[model samples]
Target: MAEESGGEKTEQPTPKKLQDAAKKGQIARSKDLGTAVVLIASAASLLIFGKMLAIAVLNIGQRLMRLDQKDIFEPNSMFTAWGDAGRELAAPLSGIFLLILVASFVGNTLLGGFNFSWEAAGPKASKMNPMQGFKRMFGLQALVELIKSILKVAVVVGVAYLLLKLFFMDIMALSLMSEPNNIESALYFLGWLFLGLCASVSIIAVVDAPYQLWNHTKQLKMSLQEIKDEHKNSEGSPETKGRIRRTQMQMSMKRMMQQVPTADVIVTNPTHYAVALKYDQGKFRAPVVVAKGVDEVAMHIRKIANEHKIPVLESPALARSIYYTTKLDHPIPEQLFAAVAQILAYVYQLKMYRKGKGSRPKSLAKDLPIPEDVRH
Candidate 1:
């Protein structure tokens, strides 16, 4: 017969993985929409806020003229006036800018888990293939741009229509309010308009950025085969894992047998399994398995019990139960309570007999006896 040979396998990307990649900004960012929206918002805010500030400055100047009883319109004072206006507006503008920055950060994080990092922003190798370049130029990324454009247009038109309906009357009545007291009213209307516009624009900017980001991530979901391949790549082949597990079990068995000499008793399946247990008064109310093993290791455990003169008893059920349920230097579980109680009773009887106090108690005789195999 001829020997068979294995062939190499190739790994492929899954739809889910591709979708996730898209979400991570592997697809292009809708920079045009994002930039235009930010610029429009910043301009609108500055214009609306600047108008309100100008009205406040005028009102303040009128009050100052009444108090000082002088022409406060001197050229030298004009520079001071501009400085005062700027200083008065500084705090509000600073607060507004801070809010904008925070909103931008939150929007980005929600969309793609993206945070500003210098490394990712840096330049790297360029793709050399013409087909790859064409794909990059007009692929899913182009679709993202088209969607962003449509969304931006819809939002802008909606906001404009609402603003016209709500604030057109306010704009017309601005000059009709002439009293100095009405100055406050005029400024209040402007503030309301500014807030309404900001609230509207911010809603679009925040929503679309994250929505696109989420869509991108959805595109990167991994298929089952991709997940398996990734596992193999990261954890090595399954055969290697099995070998590692077997090696670990062997090491554990060696360590388990090494602790057998300290055991007070060795419970056994004669030649197949061994579980060595120990107890110290006032320390352990229940006995602890000091060592346990099977096959060659089981034989080594029995040999250690013999050398240490620890009594070994053949109880197939007890031996198998302890081996399967308990681990080295750990207490046996509750289900084997009666079986373990019998083993300990036998051990105690053997100790008493060796001390020459008396014969084995009737209770101990009825239970399994400790092995004559070990002296201690």
Candidate 2:
């Protein structure tokens, strides 16, 4: 077995296994990817609407800082005044928050097939166990997380240093400069800095996303024994299916034997094969194979035909052709119609002559007019 011998999973997961995992919310996801996406999206939103947002924030700040004399003495007026200022800023604030929300959703759902399950969301005892926590700390996933954190910190520091170096003069000017326009410039500069930091950190997301997907697949891979067990569960045990098939074949043969006694004639290969045919002028356009068998089954059919007094004709070529080309209870192929018609005419003549209505017909010729394609 793939995994059972060495406890290593080697088989790819089946579709059913994937579905079961999805139901439990064991879906591949990278926290870093979601974080990067939100950060970048928020930065993009800021760059696009920086001036209007900055103006809104400044207007709200000024209104909040400069309290009215009546507002200072009366709490209701102060509350009303602050509410109006915050409401004016709400649109820009809502736009930024909404971008973050949408970006995170896109990033998380991008790699994994989307699945949400309460069972996965629910707390587990393993999460609370100190021993499990300790083991997790030393795990490969924990190591990867630590490395990612370090890389992110390094990226952030590097981007910040580069931004400050490029715009040191601009930063100094912002502090010394005047009100609204300087605020706009400052917000614009911060937007660029945030965008750069996030875009640079996204290198980790690019690496992490594929790794998380592969790791999730690795975790779910089946062993050979597991695949076998799952197959049995889904398709039923092979041994049981074999027994059922044998029983069905035996029942089918029993039914075929029952048909042998009712046949008009039994054509035979002398010892190897037997095919019992039936025909009725009003019921069929051609002869139908009622039953057929080989060797031991053929001998048994011959014994039954003898007991039932059905005519047994030993036309080896015709018998082999019917046995191979015809199906049980179905008319013979069109190519054999002439040959079978000859046999049926012979049987009819024999019957008539026995009732003394016509002269005894000549004994059936050994070689009937069998078509080349219908010949065995």
Candidate 3:
């Protein structure tokens, strides 16, 4: 047996281990990936629908600003105008919210596929433990997260500075241009800055995703002893299984030996093989092999035949053929019919002579008519 200490985890986690972990809501997931994806998607949605959103906001502002004196004084008119403003904002706001929701879902799915686990949602005491909380806050994972956050901020700031330096002339010219032209130039600079930030975050996400998966795998690794215990729990323990097998074999042997008394003759390969055969013209067309065994079981078969006063014969070829070709309680093949018939006839003659009913027949034929194809 392989020995393993609990401290060293050497075995790869089995499928069952992974499945149980999943049931408990333990899975590899990259928060960085999800964050990056949501940021990119939100930026893209704004770029695509920014004009429509601006138009909606402008229309609501214009309606509110154009109210007559009577409309402003009347409480009913004020309420109606507020309701109109809400209705105008609803479609644009809902579209942006739905886009963010879908982007977050897609981002999470890309990292760990879809997983629904009630265990993750349920409250646990461990989460409230101060020591555990402290460990989590100051652990290697926390350190890695801190480094990532610093790197992301640094990269974004550096990129923004470079972008502003490259567009310094254009930016200064914006002051000399009209208001509309200045707004357009500012929007263009913001778009490029957002894209640069998204690109940097995406690079971090790509690296972090694989690292999270590797760390999860390492956490789930098992020791050799754990693997063996899991196997014993899933399948039965080896010692118990061995006992069951031995008991079954003993019962089978008892049944086989009981059938020996009914056999007409027990043929043997002198010491190695034993085959018990019986035939009745009115019942079986061919001789039936009642029992068969090898070595120790063969010796036991011969001992039972002697106690029952049943005839025993030495015919290695016939014994091997019957043992190999016939199953217990099944008829021998047609090829061995002639050889078995001769053995049965000789045994019957010997019984009759011993009872003083007739003289003994000639010695049984040594070269029984066994077919070449059926020989073991």
Q: TM-scores, in order shown?
A: 0.62, 0.65, 0.60
**Which candidate comes out best when scored by TM-score?**
2
Q: How many backbone clashes does candidate 1 have?
A: 15
lDDT of 3 by residue, 21-70 (tens): 98889988999899889888777766655555666666777878886988
Name the regions of candidate 1 deviating beyond 4 angstroms: 1-55, 59-83, 113-119, 127-225, 234-236, 315-328, 332-376
lDDT of 1 by residue, 1-376 (tens): 1112111123344554555554433652434334445554555555556555556566557644653334454656656656776777676577557656765554445434554444445664556678888888789866866776687677767876787688778777877876553565565556665555555555655656656656544545444555777668768898999999999988887777777777889988889988888877688767898887788878888888888899988887668767877766677776666667887777888889889987965543333332332212
Candidate 3 — which residues are off by over 4 angstroms? 1-7, 166-192, 239-376
lDDT of 2 by residue, 1-376 (tens): 5345745578888999998999888888988888889889989989877888989888878887886777767858877867888888788878888888888789778888577998899999989999999989999989999999999899889988998899889988997878898999999999998898899879899999999989999999988778888899888888889998999999999999999999999999989999999998799888899999999999989999999988898899999999989999999999888788888888888888888988888877887777887676
Highest-lDDT candidate: 2
Cand. 1 Cα-lDDT: 0.65
Give the residue spans of candidate 2 off by over 4 A: 1-28, 45-105, 115-130, 164-191, 213-245, 251-265, 278-290, 299-313, 327-331, 346-363
| Order of quality (lDDT) | 2, 3, 1
